[model samples]
Target: MHQETRLLIGQISDTHIRPKGQRYHGVADSNRMLAQAIAHLQGLDRRPDLVLLTGDLVDKGHPDEYAMARELLAELAIPCLVVPGNHDHRDAFRAAFADHAWLPAAGPLHFCVDTHPVRIVALDSTVPGAHHGAIDEAGLDWLHTTLAADRAKPTLVVLHHPPFASGIPYMDGYALRAPERLAQVIGAFDNVERVLCGHVHRLMLRRWAGTVVCSCPSTTTEIALRLQPDARPASFMAPPACMLHLWSAADGMVSHLSTIGDFEGPFDFA
Candidate 1:
């Protein structure tokens, strides 16, 4: 891996940050776990060029929650890109990240970043008062234009909802609505390398839109992976994790799941 040609992007999702001193669902120490995730990123042998935070930034759409999220994110030394999830309030989220020039002043929080080796197109799929996600016609049109603008660069299309169902009936109930609409646009662009998402709270991958769609694991808890139709809704204190995406001109992109916490490792093999 040539250092100059390769770019490492750290992805941490579904942080679900709450007000200071409060835990997510009164079980997971979301704030502390996010801190640990940030520390883990900073301590990596090779630091990421930037970090992408897929959504569910807060448990509730509260200003105080966003405040707590901002405070925790401030610890990150590199630039962070964000998208809104079902739990986020658009107005409050925009206000919290007003400093980011890439964020639009109005409308859905969709934007594109082309400064890095790979292009990033972040879509806002949150429905104001609903847990299910959808991309209206206007959003799809915008995506078409954005993707058309640069067809040669390797791109990443990011959104809060995974476009495909996870087979977990309860979670699938809120999956992206009319995914084929988005797929049609994405399928046309051969430069797109991956579609990144986070609402699932579990790492998932699927082949869609001529590319790979990967959902990041949460920093707080893992939604129980029950695939049965009658399974109950639940979450557990599974080891929190994040994704590391490495891209280079020669290798394209490779993703790795990194667990966040203290674990014994680096033993000498003689």
Candidate 2:
């Protein structure tokens, strides 16, 4: 398909950026890794039409952390959209990205963007002062209305937490509460392409809500995947990565996981 008919979206999630000069949990350098992810996106052969940050943008819900995140994200030349995560404070997040026109003045950081070939409906699943996620009645109503408004356009629904049980005990403990409720609204729309998420800190995919639910890996650490019910919570300094979703009128969306690091040569098959 022609390039003009395609829309490429770069997705980076769970950055968990901390204040300048500080490390996440006094260990992982989330800030530096985020910078590298931005560089990787910038250096891509086909630059993304836009970028979606699935949340946990900062380690803490502090204003200074948001400031640091803003500084690092400023390096990205592509337009970016964000949704609040468990680690984010709604008010602080709003104040940080106040300049973005798509952000609402108050309430959950929910909004829809129609400027591209595919429509974007970003939902705030973060529940204040909690690690789990949920969408209130109002948010659900808003989502139904928004999706119903543009049923023909391919759409992406962005949220912070995965809407399905990850099978990893620790992570599933804090997964989106009542996913079926959200699914009910999403399953009603056939044009809804994908439900993108972050919180699990690992890449995961499932078919739900009449669409694919893909969770992007964190740019800093990977949540240990232990299916045992008694599995402990742990993270590793694994290879960071990002997701590139390419959509076209003729072909549907195809996602690729791009590892964020300097690797060996890209040799030819011949």
Candidate 3:
């Protein structure tokens, strides 16, 4: 049996697998990135109990892409939960990963987990044919009821879109359409621990309604960060990366950034 006392969760988001099996940004092989990340996970001393795949598993919401996603994820030795982003096809995703339990099916895969001291809530914020994210009223109601149902366990909310903008203009524009409502819900709950998201293709952390909000980076490509206003945005010279999250009742949750590559140049420089 698994230990509910403390949990190690691995997150990989936004693979954007090219259907034709094309390379990304002319370097940093995409499929190989996933493979290498798995190897890295295997090397981890403390293995993750579960893997959360935030979104954008496929580049264009194509079945072929989801098929590739299955093949890539199948190499992992841990259980995984998947959600869809604007670029994903829900039906296709469901067909690909048929084993994932779907409930309160308003849309983008809403599920809950009682893994750690803090319960994990996976929300679907993707609206079909759109980039911006929104949690429908029914979903929000479910969230409210779900939180109200349990106040003992601190909760961590995971979604595909950042509830708030991440300072990047293009991505910020496509952020959660109505963030105040999200904030209000979290604010209402003293047990809400942290909020997790992926879509900006970078790591973004901010405080919202007295809770820690973090957005994980992409598994394949990263958007150019826009610290300064410019007609053009940040570039993708940076490699594909993900975040490994460690959670404990004694210490809370800690997220660590990870790259998706395996390089064997030099163990030691002499």
TM-scores for every predicted model: 0.98, 0.98, 0.89
Candidate 1 residue-wise lDDT, 7-34, digit = tens: 8999999999989999898999999999
Clashing pairs in 1: none
lDDT of 3: 0.78
State the lDDT of candidate 3 residue by residue for 48-163, as single tens digits.
88788888877777788778878877899997777788788777877777766544333557888875555888888988888889998888888888888898787888899988
Candidate 2 contains a number of clashing pairs equal to 0
The digit string of per-residue lDDT tens for model 2 on 1-270 reads 645589999999999999999999988999999999999999999999899999999989999999999999889999999988999999999999999999999899999999999999999999999999999999999999999998899999999999999999999989899988998999999999899999999999999989999999999999998999999999999999999999988889999999999898888875
Off by over 4 Å in 1: 1-4
Give every collision pair in model 2. none
Q: State in Å the error of residue 200, model 3.
A: 0.8
lDDT of 1 at 59: 89
Clashing pairs in 3: 224-234
